[model samples]
Target chain A: MAVNDMTKLTLGPIAYHWSADTRRDFYARIADEAPVDEVYLGEVICSKRAPFHEADLPETIDRLERAGKTVILSTLAEVMLKRERKATEDLAAMETPEIEINNAAGLFARGKRPHRIGPFMNAYNEATIRWMAGQGATHICLPGELPADAIAVAAKAARELGLGVEVQVFGRASLAVSARCYHARAHDRTKDNCQFVCEADADGMPLRTTDNSPILRVNGIQTQSESYVALLPETGELIANNISHLRLMPQAVDMVAVATVFRDVLDRARAVDDADAMLRSVCRTTPFSNGFYHGKAGYRRIAMASPA
Target chain B: MSLAELICPAGTPAALRTAVDAGADAVYCGFQDATNARNFPGLNFTPDELAEAVVYAHAKDAKVLLALNTYPPAGKVDLWRQAADTGTRLGVDAFIVADMGVADYIARTHPQVRLHLSVQAAASSPEAIRYYCESFGVKRVVLPRILTIPEIRQIRREIPCEIETFIFGNHGLMVEGRCSLTNYLTGQSTNMDGICSPASEVDYARHDDGSMSSRLAGFTIDCFGADEMAGYPTICKGRYTAPHRPEAYYAFEEPVSLNLSRLLPQMIDAGIHAFKIEGRQRSKSYVRNVVSAFRAAVDDIRAGRTANIADLVALTEGQKQTQGAFETKKWR
Candidate 1:
């Protein structure tokens, strides 16, 4: 049951605007209990959420680092306002802990300094990954929409260039980001007068189709899938393709226990069926999906044949 | 201020002629493949047709900007590279590119050719625009539709390359080259496949309640009453129900087109170099009327005369239009 030694488990940035106390507690639990090797921190969806938690960043980073987990700060996925530009500049100027850039403005600000490419940045092909490597990208988390074959090709290209390749294996898939904040607009509020309404739905507001089918989630300006993307069974294929990391996006579930289950599966200590049952129990109401990896509709649940 | 060049869309060669003849300074088109953003079926140009289009456009002193804007999939860069080679050989005026790979290839292979950053690249900030201009020698950037007038003016002052903003047509507020909403439901995407809510997967069903539901791949996007006009269900403009709201709402945007007709003078004063129209899937009459109207308007503004705005609600989607975010940040 031994996996690739480089196949580390990573936690993506929190895409929601949780209260500063809640964020501190979440990071404290993750720092001490989770089996993940890396943790990404920042307010990636909205700039308005940064100020509420800025004073507590040093303690979170120190705790994660002290617990032997690598910490990476992420930039805003969309930078338009003057404050956002300044924030990207300030983060890009840092030289200590690494920065994961999600927007092109961060790329310009970093300017050949080594940084990680967040999943929000589109790295869909070998040519694009190679070009990013030329721009000093040391690691890249591929876009969530890319299919399996494309991931294999991109992973191979990245491996050949000595860059780390990571793929999201758990949690809600981020589908789209917009200039306007849908979470606010849905509540009859403009983005400017949102009043931090997104802080209500920590897991994101549920958006249902006309027939009342729960299909999508609205997280501030981002649109995400209702089902969590679980790829526990496909870890073998991902490792075979030379992927170096598996990312699990932070959600409201018991992430410490969730990370333990994934770690058990990765370590060959638990059977796939047992792990699947455990995950289902952990994520009670949400469904599991791997259709994006199977080259079908992302929300589809293509049943996989049992492994030999 | 100098009159800004009018850039128009041409899905077919006939539309190309119509645009140029209607007073478009330049016409943007794509091959009948995934290399361009508007890779719709039965639309776009073949190599032979593109050669003829270049000749016809050059004869009338109009420029032909070939759009190879979609991202090249892994292990399939040859298609985009070959398309670039074809466009270069066909004597196109410039290339509108979105992917960094395609931009790098074009910049390295054909240094003499001009490169314009497509809106699909989502280069909304001055720093992002500067990165493209410096890294790949991109000469012009079609700014995304999310910026306000003051933001555009500030960006124009900071960046070195020419600026192009959408003046009419699709008010796609989503950051281009990044949206995956359609792909989440249909397995196809605008960034990789050059289609959004593709027509092939779209269907309409009449319910027993005397209402029709517009769907993409069987997911109900919106239901229209008998008297209400049902717009095409592009994912962003679709209506959906949320938990806090009692009724379905346009979570992203309403069904309307962006018509910045009255802001021509202010746009010119903001140092915009080109004004772009965003409908490659539109008809020949649409091309003619919109192009001629904007042509006369640009002329009137440059000549210090008040431009007469025309009523173009019929040509817009849902028979309605708005000035969108360009007028104010409050539209969000």
Candidate 2:
């Protein structure tokens, strides 16, 4: 309630596998054109894709930082094997850019160092957020599954803790992360020999219900919503509350244009309805969903006349 | 001569007593509240009943582990704190916790109480497990059902805590303590509200062809053929259609219960300290039967004899069973 017009815009770590050139070009564009204030850089989904883009991390970080954007390196969402553990340690060992922790292992590796808590860390309540702050988390991105009321509650708690609260205002909502790769399994390929199958689906493989209803999306081990979470109608309430940072997850769309529309709505230069229409036109992604923000089914889109 | 302890589930006080009398080494349950994962209707013990159940289990030389595992809402952590406090007062053996806040509270409030990292924590790596052990003095961890025998063996050598594993029931493929598919449909999460495929929303209908269709909160989860046994309407078990596939298939996982009875000896050799059976919503007869059967198996393994595994086919959900990810990682 004491915050400004709205929160700063932040871009979450990309959860897909884009080609090396695509990753380079995407960050290049994000650094030069996007309206995001902070950009998270790293492989947060699968470790196999890290090497493909790992070589370009320095350039990407430099590009973003030189463009006056804060950079945070994110760790994998679920770390299990020795290789993944080493990857987390490597990220923690970095000196220039701070780390965003998605797995609990990052807490151990980044001992006492200031870090950001990614949405995958499950900071559902005040106690969890405060504990993360006590452990040196500078910012905490609450999961997309939280309703608007829960978001406001956590944002207030984060404000009290001096930790920024981030909400995922765009992109497909991640539902679950598993050890098995359904993307690879679908092709009768094992995870070890996945052969980079997930790269084929630039965004993510769409999974529909038996009636051809888009229900879930598979990106290797992570299962996400088949719909994109749109919060244009509720951004006012989010700003009226104490949300500190609004995160726009990178999807396979005209992301710069998408961010432009969101930035315009935040600046009041465009009405929410016009911005929503522009967003829908630019994002050739899935249907819109505001269910998680309203404490309803996550895949449905519901119109609200008044904010809670 | 105590091999791995046989841990069983008990939703009711009667079931708890039945498990203890049937020869369980330990029985785990939760209070009838959101603090536990099995927050089903007409299931779980009351706080007063838990006190009596703990006494009964202790009298029968069985341990009582209270599951206070669900993640509380942003401002409503009192429910979880109260559950932990009440369980501690009842003299439970260990508290199964998932949320970092709840674990921190338990570790600070009652440092003497044993804390077991619930599978809901999804701490699969050695570093994650070591973090819990170092931060909260967690004595044990219920390993998630996503690891293989070799992976478990390697993890055991690396972590400081004793490992408890699910040996039977709910071979759920979705990562435990992390799934929100149920919430995506019914607005109730297994991690927060502790209910999934909630009974209030589940409906079953018989088709004209004698097949059965199961729905959860008005969404069709799955349908079964005439001979195919129907399963609970969990989102993961339902068939889905994708653009790449022509017909609907089990995109997530099939309806199969985890039956690790055949792999008990290997698991014991793999250095598991406790073998857990999941099913807090089951009946006392089911608890008694399962406890008695697993008791004989663990006793046989202790005596250096091959355990005679029972055919629990009839008791399994969907009338199907699988070794799950414990034997291999390709159950899908």
> Judged by DockQ, which candidate is best?
1
lDDT, residue B285, model 2: 90
Task: Give the worst 10-residue stretch by lDDT in candidate 2 chain A.
Answer: A1-10
| Candidate 1: tens digits of C-alpha lDDT, residues A1-308 | 45535679999999999999999999999999999999999989999889999899999999999999999999999998999999999999999538999999999999998999999778889999999999999999998878889999999999999999999999999988888999889878889999999999999999887878888899998989999999988887888898899999998999998999888888878887888889989999898888889888888877777641
List chain B TM-scores, each candidate. Answer: 0.97, 0.95
Candidate 1 stretches with Cα past 4 Å from truth are A1-4, A306-308, B311-318
Cα shift from native, residue A187, model 2 (Å): 1.3
Q: Give per-candidate clash totals.
A: 0, 0
Interface RMSD of 2: 1.5
Model 1 agreement with the true structure over B21-40: per-residue lDDT tens digits:
99999999999999998889
* Model 2 lDDT per residue over B129-176, tens place: 998999899999999898888999999999988999999887778778
Candidate 2 residue B160 C-alpha distance from true site, Å: 1.8
Q: Note the Cα lDDT for every prediction shown.
A: 0.90, 0.86
Best of the candidates, TM-score: 1
The sequence of per-residue lDDT tens digits that candidate 2 reaches over residues A168-265 is 98988889888888888787787888999889898899877654567788899989888898888788888878887888889999899988887877
